[model samples]
Target: MSSIFKWEAKPFFDMVTRRQTLQAISTTALPALAGCTTDILDSGKSQTRYTLNIEPIEVSPVEHALFDPDDDALFGNPAQTALAAILPDGRHTTYGYEPLPDDAYVEYEGSYYQTTNLVTGRKQMERTLIRAEPLPDKADVPNDAILVDELNRPAARVVKILHSNAVTGGEGNSAELLREDAYVLRRPVERESRLATGELDGRIVTMTDGGNWAYRLHVTHKRITETAHTTLAIEVANSHSQFRDVVFGSRIDVELTPENLSADVRNLLEDAVRRETYEETVPLPETFEALLTALGLKAVDTAVTGKLLWYDGELYRCALYVNDSS
Candidate 1:
């Protein structure tokens, strides 16, 4: 419970506080204009539902580790036991031997037990070797093998913006784009802790079982900010013979670092993305529509596009050709 509390404290606080404030403000302000156009909002023509499409988001410059509860449980346990083989019936027992009493011999009926060396008196028990099978040998490997697997494995990730107006269907703006298809590969990976104080990486990760200690991986959504405005640079180029607006199914998710994202444009992006992604089908666009409905701005609506990149710790080098933003 303490761990869960710690893991989700910020999100919970943000949600609770925001809800209380909104409720209080709505209560104070609603009655003033309560009767004006109240029924008009529910009318079919005025209440058109818009689909929000989001792009798949990736953790840029993938980090080394994350928090793993499964590994913690396994490694935290103190008592360690291993199944060992016992010798055959033709065994000799010297002094200090603790033989199982005939009445106490129900469990391991055909097995023989010998006592430990009286000098240490560790109460060690030895069984006669029957036919214990050994585990197959695995070749030596490194913990960083997942880096190779990511290139091959089929993975699911979330890509969309997050904002207050995303799912809330009122007269307010929409949500912002943050991430896409955010998912874990098989088991998550981990490593030594390296996060800001009071913050933890709760992403499940995994690695090849070679080293003695299983290292977990931590990944957090990061933003490059220069003050109040958050910035995200995307690379787009002209791919076709001429400039054109090509709208493929897309969505984006944005997770603020320390959960502090306060930008109208960013929020709109998230809302639009969420609405698009939560749809049964995503529409296609040939020309970039800057003012698609009353939603957010299309930052990049170029025909020539760059390759979709993942976290590999290198500058994403690709062509750039501008297209219509409106």
Candidate 2:
């Protein structure tokens, strides 16, 4: 006659790996941050502050389920006996047992028992607590068909079997980790009208003779306040159109909101933008000979001109190879 048995082995450390993975998935949370903007200044004059508000984007959560494991073979066989094994405490070795052909067994409260199945014409052995450990101090157990922790938490112990059946026991559940947040992208919606003297501060204009000139542009606004993520465009115009072109660099203090943007991140983007804007041309001493030698030119007779252009979205290019003698 075929004999039946049951047993439990540390709930199978495999379950431990699965639980750890679940725990990890349960703890990952990332905050959705937003809001970015830039302002432009015209000469010495500043633009009025503006505010813009828009709809916010909302985030949501995802859900799923968990499964239990199987535990069998410890109570159906008669020859099964508990085998001493290492426990979690290391100081003590616990015993684990399964059914065998020679002895009938049953298990309860760390004990074993053997019985006969008269209807089935067979014998069975079982283990009550072959390998059981105390619940973690921070964990709680729960009530349900599934084995849970002290906190009514499920699946503290699990044993997986064929066809994904629970030959033993465990809990299966899923939960969300990241909380929901909203994002709002705003642009300057309105501006206040003010009188201007038509002069901008800290601006350079060239004279008809190609001489350097400095002009202070006047602005109507004394201060400005703007909402986050608002980009402002300021137009620079020369009433006199005296200079063929004006070339100069200026600095302005910009305030950014920390609510949605980190300082380090904004700083990084700003540094990159500044690096691409200006060219630190190292002019070869007034000596044309030095220029020829530096450029690897065969002679100083060739006139070399450099022009740089800046495009939207940080795009830039140089026309260094503009001439052809082929």
> In candidate 1, residue 298 scores what lDDT?
34
Model 2 deviation from native, Cα RMSD in Å: 46.1
Note the clash tally of each candidate. Answer: 77, 57
Error of 2 at 49 (Å): 52
Model 1 bad stretches (over 4 Å): 1-46, 57-263, 270-326
Task: Report the poorest 10 consecutive residues by lDDT, candidate 1.
Answer: 76-85
Counting only residues 3 or more apart in sequence or on different chains, how many pairs clash (N, Cα, C under 3 Å) in candidate 2?
57
Tens-digit lDDT track of model 1 for 1-326? 12222344456467668778567556655663454445444342322222334444343222111111122211211101100111222222222222211111111232322212122222232211101111122332233332212322212111011112222432233222121311111111111112221122332222323422122223443332211111111112133211111111111111222123335534544554445332111132322232231222234343223322211122121222332221
Could you tell me the lDDT of residue 171 within candidate 2?
24
lDDT of 2 by residue, 1-326 (tens): 01111323356445668777555434431111111111112223432221111111121100000011123332321122221111111111111211221222223233222222112122232211111222332223322212122211011111111101211222212111101110011111101111121121222222112221211112222222221211111122232121111111111012223333345534432443455321112222233223223223323232332322222222222212212221
Model 2 residue runs over 4 Å out of place are 1-227, 240-243, 247-289, 292-326
